[model samples]
Target chain A: MSDMSLATPRAYRRPSTRRIQVLALLTALVAGLILLTLSCGRGCLAPGDVFAALTGAPGADASFVVSELRLPRAVLGLVAGLSFGLGGVAFQVMLRNPLASPDIIGISASAGAAAVFAIVILSVDGWLVSLIAVVAGLGVALLIWTLSARRGAAGARLILIGIGISAMLDSITSYVLLEAPAWDRAEALRWLTGSLNGAQLTQAIPVAGALLIFGGLLAFTARDLEALRLGDDTAQALGVRADGTRLRVTLAAVGLVAIATAATGPIAFVAFLSGPIAARLLPGAKGLLLGAALVGAFLVIAGDFVGQFLLPARLPVGVVTGAVGAPFLLYLIIRANKNGGTL
Target chain B: MMRAERPHRFAGFAILLGLLVLTVGLSLTVGARAVPWDEVWAGLLGQIDSIGAAAVAVRVPRTALAVLAGGALGLAGAVMQGISRNPLADPGILGVNAGAALFVVIGIAWFDISGAQNFLWLGIAGAGLTAVFVYLVGATGQGGATPLKLTLAGTATSVAVSAFIIAVVLPRNDIAGSVQSWQVGGVGGARFDTLLPAVPFAVVGLLLSLASARVLNALALGEELATGLGQSVALGRLMAAAGAVVLCGTATALCGPIGFVGLVVPHLCRMIAGVDYKLVLPLSTLAGASMLGLSDVLGRVVARPNELDVGIVTAFVGAPFFIWTVRNNRMRGL
Candidate 1:
């Protein structure tokens, strides 16, 4: 409408992929990282010890450390990663804007804000946090959608509106945390930095189940999503029912993101990074859904490990991913700006 | 949105000044404690004998800081939009605040820097550098610094910077409390001693912005046309942006980064004073001060014993307004 043109640029992709080999390599690599996290902690354990601990072997010494401490945390990371990856890519694909990832746009902010409110004000815990986060995430999406839809060309407007909304929500989150009567370190850290320091095996269950249901929902619409990346007119011409596809995908993706955020506290930019990283890793791959999901898992396992060991002081996964993702995002923006907004 | 005739322009200024007077009054008298009018007057005269007088005394410097800082942010935001020709160009929205935060945070974490003057320079430097970086990044490729592109670039930078700050703060218990205020802006801790160092900087920045009004006007008519009219587009853009940076940098250094005053005030002023930078800039200053002063009062009153930060108050008020602006306007660039 003004000087800047919102001519939507399309990224080229299809179901075409390097296929199973790349996917297998990423899975195996992620598995190795998870195992590595299991082995190296306060005291190192051999792969032999880890294997026996997993199998409920007799006289397993580090069984609690393996099954309780490390195992649930790893499972939480892996499951939450998949949720973020799947959810993030779905939005980017549907919106055709990398910056439209849930984290940047305010869905994740809504969840984090809700989580903080629940913890500080309501003094709630467990599944209740998950429930509130999920509800808030969907509500924010609707809020952004309704507000942005008031104008012409909702694409760029939506993301910009979302950013504005996201800032507001973030301020609320910070304000509540600051005024929190009882300073709970873990509760504060979970909302502030997205940590896995106190992951419960119980927490992993609902998140994994969320990944399964919402991820499956996303997968069912995967083909239509591919058609979406080609833009709305072209997709409709190919009988893709663009609006229906967008609505369903958005709901499913928001659900995935909120549920995972409730469990892991919006693990900073995993959702933002996964799609683009996976697309690069498996070049020409359409429906980068599975690949991106796996990348999310890999990033969490690897990021948590780095935060735990590589850093000067042990940090949260969100902090590590945020630090890593920011530079990559800048690179993408710089390159895209140079290439006239192309990926 | 047409040019204001002479009479309407005069009326606009009068209305704005009157609004400022009202808000300043509200800020002085209304707070956690309801100070009577005579006591507020007595408090202004340095009498702190009564409880209401003492409460009024405590709020005076805070109110002063709110006015000055709010004016700086609002003026900065107007100049930002004027120079960039983007409606979305607020200090906070553009990630300049984040940049300032990054430098001040680094200074705190590594060097253990203290004092307002030290942070002022760091904040200005960071704000200036980030402004340049975001502009370059946004202005790259075919569409140069489109509103959407710039906003996105700023958003990404802000997100990245926040992560970095959290990382630095999380590990060290010592610096964490100090940085928390920087993360969340407020004037609750306002003191004249702290406020005094910032006044000269704020005045210079304010004058510099007001002085560049004609140059900003000339450049508004496309870069080449402004050059055709013997105006230096790059030089003018830089000068105006410098004033904005100084203003925002000083405000941020003083009160952390308060969002939305810069964003909301300029837009409101434009609605009142048209697109003319001279009218917009001054009007934004008054409106911003009024808004922040009133918000500070609201913050004090709303929660009773506890006070909400002015930054949080503005966020609640401004974000919806921002979203509304985005919705009503037809924007391009993704």
Candidate 2:
């Protein structure tokens, strides 16, 4: 055993050096993206004016735009993006599949469908719709989990089932939108496309809370997740209750994603893309929860900035992320295939 | 295996064909305006120029379009699954639907193109180009487009294409209302003249799909086994993929990119007819036509005065079945 261990020569870091370096880089990127999002919008404010507004100093027009509009929008993007990132990484590590993000697993689609149904059919507004969305997201995830568990909880079967459910939920959403009144059509489309347009400070409160709670739980379980990544039998041999850790991690991840969806209407591929990108940046990092969350935040803030200012016509954050993430997804697929790795 | 199964398979085919005829008849008889069987029969015989007969006459084109599109999709789907050797594969998984959608959106938003004929052309062009692009992207890589790689490539193309569609459609509210209905997949607004050009394409696709079954059978045994059998595995895959693209492109044009028929019907057929491509291909075609026709009929019944899109109804029907398929199969890797 000693000779085998010596021959293998597994590399170990203090978790201080590698993780901190990567985290610092992500922190810098997130800060920069937030600043860019705040400064670049319609009636664009100068950096000095934006910073002043953020600090609660008075500057009439700049203050109004920055405080009322850009602040909430940016804050929501930051919080929701972090939730998605953390939730996404949790699922990837737990399930051991890069494609096992919340959006791909029917959670986001079900949430979107419920929200659209509330908006178009029930005529419910604001908080009530968000409540329904969170419940529905959890309900759908539970359903997929139960159904896929019939054969044993293989990730491939779960993903296939999730894709099927997502497609069905999408059809339901499209049907509701089709029957919606003209007045509701634009609002529905905007929400469906996942915009930060018309974001309110009140909306950010629950999202931030969910992020804190679930993100904390996920951080606590990060060590277990790293062990789980070594395979279930090995994890159990290491004195980890593999199933318990997986359940706790998945529940927290689902909750985070549900709340994020309620806030941002399933912003395209933020969750789907963030963990993979974070892994690429911090190669061989354990768990990737923090890095992934930060990457998600960056994607959302930068995507929002680009959609609002870079394009000729204003687009949604979801659209920008989708456009950017899809090519990355393709590249990942190709690279994974070449390396004979399961995506 | 072939000789032993031939008699029983022929019997099953006969039953399916009979069901297809019944579905066609029901499709003619039921709609927004329910017409009596006698009047429909008279309309068929051209025995009367009555008002009810005119309604029956109108139903003919739509029903025919359903049959053509459904058969093409099912056949293409069977071929796709056989070639990819992945049960999850379907015609839409080839990037056809997304490509067609993108082009149609472009046509409406930028070129101001309208009318069914123009939409048909644009859809075909989009689907064909997207399929070719995905194939090239998947095939050029180190392992030459394994099932997983192809599926990923198709999904990525779909995501990017839909994003482009949203980007184009969002700012232009003028096209939103029309494009919304078109994107959902339907046969409600099809005209005989609009469907004319697609008929030849569908027919050719169907013929090629049927002819490629032997190749699919060999291909299904894995590339090494197929090559050992002295088959040009790459050429076979190319032919099968091309046939699928043509069938899928035509179907999308005729009926706004219907989902699940291509994905679901083939699986259903395989369950009844077993896994041989010879039985699966033809059975899928029959079952597909019947399924779409019946769904369209059900769509009319569900919403009463207001109709649900057949696409939505199929999803409602197919989702559970798809889940069941996944749950039952142990899903031996791709």
Flag clash pairs in model 2: none
lDDT of 2 by residue, A72-157 (tens): 99999999899888888888777788877888778888888987888778988777876787788878877888887754564567
Give the per-residue lDDT of model 1 (tens digit) for B257-313: 788889999888888888888788899999989888988888998888888999999
Give residue B331's error in model 1 in angstroms.
4.1
Candidate 2 regions with alpha-carbon error over 4 angstroms: A1-15, A51-59, A150-154, A182-187, A283-287, A337-343, B1-4, B32-58, B114-118, B135-149, B221-236, B329-334
Q: In angstroms, how far off is A341's CA in candidate 2? A: 4.2
Q: Give the C-alpha interface root-mean-square deviation per candidate.
A: 2.5, 2.6
lDDT of 2 at B328: 65
- Give per-residue CA lDDT, model 1, range A111-215, as digits (tens): 989988997899988889888998999899988888776433336777778888888998888878878869754347545768888899998887888888888
TM-score of chain B of each: 0.96, 0.88
lDDT of each: 0.84, 0.80
What is the per-residue lDDT of model 2 for residues B1-334, given as tens digits with 9 covering 90 to 100?
2342667778769988998999998888888777777788887776667877877887788888888888888888888788777676666656677798788789889998977767767877887798778876766557776655676677778778877888998898877766767777888887788888777777777887888888888887878999999988888778777778778877876677677787788887766677788888999999889888989888887777778888788878887877776676543343
> What is the TM-score of each predicted model, taking all chains together?
0.94, 0.89
